[model samples]
Structures are given as C-alpha cells and as structure tokens.
Target: MCSYGSKLVAPWTIASPISAKICRLRQVAKRFYNFGSKEYKSAFGDAPFFDSQGLRERTIQYIKNFDASIWHKDPIRTIVKGNYFIQGVESDTTNAIGNINGKQIFADKETFEKITAHISSSALRYEVSKCKDLMKAVRRLEADLL
Candidate 1:
C-alpha cells in the first residue's frame, strides 16, 4: 500500500518516461477546479469529481440554505401571506389579477406535501417511461446491485 504524502510522487520517480508524462497530466488535472463535464479521475472515471474548493463551496451552500425561520415554528398547515406572493413576470395586469387567487390557489407546506405524495411516484414513473432510453443509465433499476 502507498503512503499519502509520497505515494504518487514516489511512483513518478520510478515510472517510465511515458508513464511519468501520464502521471504529470493527471497531476495537472487533479489541480483543476473546472465545474464542467470534462472532469475525470482515471481515464474512464465517473462524474461528480469535486476538487477541494468545489467540495467546500457545496458545503457552504448547504449550510447557507438552512432555513432558520422554520426553526421556531411548526410546518405550515395553511397558506401564509408570504406564500401568497409568487414571483413571476411583473406587469400591471399580472399584479392586479395573477396574485390573490385568480384561478389557482397557493397551498401551505402540509397541503402541498399531501397533494404531491398522491401523484409523486406515479408522475415520476410516467416521466421515466416517456424517455426511457435517455435516462436508462442513471435511473434506478429493478435488479439488485451486486
């Protein structure tokens, strides 16, 4: 087994010139912070290859997204005044008619959860079956994992 500090470097000194060049390329790639699809580890590696800074940004964003306002109160059962406001195209006609119950009514958290729960699983199945080929690789399989 290789040690942490000298593992890759120690191998580089002993490796052939071609191997050394490959390792050097990997070293440069390891330093990259690109949040793009070109990311890899070994030649045919997986997606979601987060470097140190990318991981840190995601960690901070997770903490920043925590709802402090919800800490004191229970989950909402009815629509609040704040929930009534939906941000969309801002126009005089839209302002007068769209908000404050035009055709559809905004539900509170509890109601929204209940309504979604009824349709969620079926709706997801419908969506997946619609484009089965495109989503085949990532979508969950019926077979057990080895």
Candidate 2:
C-alpha cells in the first residue's frame, strides 16, 4: 500500500477491491467515450446540442411531426415524460431522456431522431412544468430533443 502522511495514497492501485472497481469503471468509460479525444470533437461537440450534419434538421422535423396522442396509450411515453421531470432539473447530465437511453442516445442519427419523435411535450408540461425541480430538466431536454 502506497501511503503518505499516514494515509493510503493509492487505494485504486489493485489493493482495495472497492476502489479498484470504481477506478476501473471510470477508466473504461473514459476510454470508451474518449471524452477529450479529437474524434469526439468530430461529433456533436462537448454538449448535447445537435450540431451534427443534418441532425438538427432531423430533430426539428421529428419534434414537429411527433404525435402527442402517442402518449395516451403507450406505456413507454410515461417513461420519457418521467425523464423530462428529472433530466436537466437534477443536473446537466442524465441517464435517460424520454425513451432515449442516456448510454447511447446520441450514438447515431437514427436513434436520435427516433427519440425526438417519441417525446411528448404536452405530457411533460403537464407533469413537470408545475414542479420547479423538474422544469429545469424539462427545459434542457426540450432544447436538445426538440
């Protein structure tokens, strides 16, 4: 165990199981996302803003053509609406957005468009607009998804 000033200095250095797991997770995520890589720069940029080729147009068209009635019967609409209630409201990052999976929601143009097409703005307003905590999340998601 590496130590300094009476405290362990390398808990994640394969000595502590818990620390090693956490550190390994971070390593895998950082390597997979390559968040600082120039390849990431070729993507939609650091933020979730739709800055890709023809992506912004597709998102807009999807939102504009999205049918709000789709929320009335489908069980999944509830899921996306639930996401709006907490997404950006709790923080700048989220694990999901509507039917959008946070893990790969932005992976490709098709998935991104599908997510935008499924989001229910009215249901979101009904559920989240009244709550201060959720409104921020709603706003952020709306801006990105819409």
Candidate 3:
C-alpha cells in the first residue's frame, strides 16, 4: 500500500519485470512507501511468479462477486496486499488498515478479533473483509515467506 497524501492506495502486483519496474517508479515518483521499498525489495521480488496459477485475477474476480453482506452488514473494503508486505517476516497478522463508517479505523489481527469478539462470525467476516485492501497487502507480505 502506498500513501498518497493521507489516503492509502494499493495496486495488485502482477508477476512481471515491467510491473516491478513500474512499482519501483511508483516508489520514487509518488513517494509510495511500501514494505518492498522499505526492505529493499521490489514488488516482483515479493511475488515472483505469483500469478502462475492465475490466482491473482481469479481472486480479484472472486472478490468482485463475493457478497459483502453475507459476511457482514457492511461491504468488504477490498484491500489487496502484494507479497512484499511480508518479506523476511515469519508470521505477522497484527497489522491492519482501513475504515469503518466515516471514521478511520486501524488495528492488528488480534486486536481486531478482540474488538469484534461479540459480533457474529458473518458480521466479523464482513468487517474483516471490509479491510480487503489491507488484508490483500498483508497476504502479499505473507507471500515473501513462501
């Protein structure tokens, strides 16, 4: 995720040299502060051949079709994290970023679980899904471990 002004923008990283170059350029041009740049890794470095199974495209399509209400009262936010977010990390599920209602919300996995402990599984799923973009980035980070 790149911080554009006060907002965060996440671009799915395709497995290609061109995409890597573009990501590098984004880091320089837009001052996009992603885990890749922070760890001296490019987007490609994080997700080498990630789309080998067409999972990226399929996942995007699935996300588009998946019913947000089935999981929660609100829609899923659709956070897409590339593999770079987890480079060199063993297991980190505590980082979260997104919004709920009009207020900006941020929390880690454990904290999120505790905060919404009272909510039903479906609603919890929706709230977590709402942070899709952040979770996507988190998944990207997890890819580095693979």
Each prediction's whole-model lDDT (CA): 0.46, 0.50, 0.45
What is the C-alpha RMSD, rounded to one decimal, of candidate 2?
18.7
Q: Which model, 1 or 2, shows the larger lDDT?
A: 2
Q: How well is each residue in 58-99 modelled by candidate 2, as lDDT tens digits?
A: 988999998755443332311343443212111122334545
Scored against the true structure, residue 76 in model 3 reaches a CA lDDT of 28
* Per-residue lDDT value at 9 in model 1: 55
Report residue 100 deviation for candidate 1 (angstroms): 33
Cα lDDT tens digits, model 3, 51-84, are 5468878988999898644433432232222212
TM-scores for all candidates?
0.20, 0.24, 0.22
Cα lDDT of model 1 by residue, 30-129, tens digit: 6785655453233334446559998899999989997644422333233322243332232221235564222222455665675466445534553354
Identify the candidate with maximal TM-score: 2
Clashing pairs in 1: none
How do the candidates rank by lDDT, highest first?
2, 1, 3
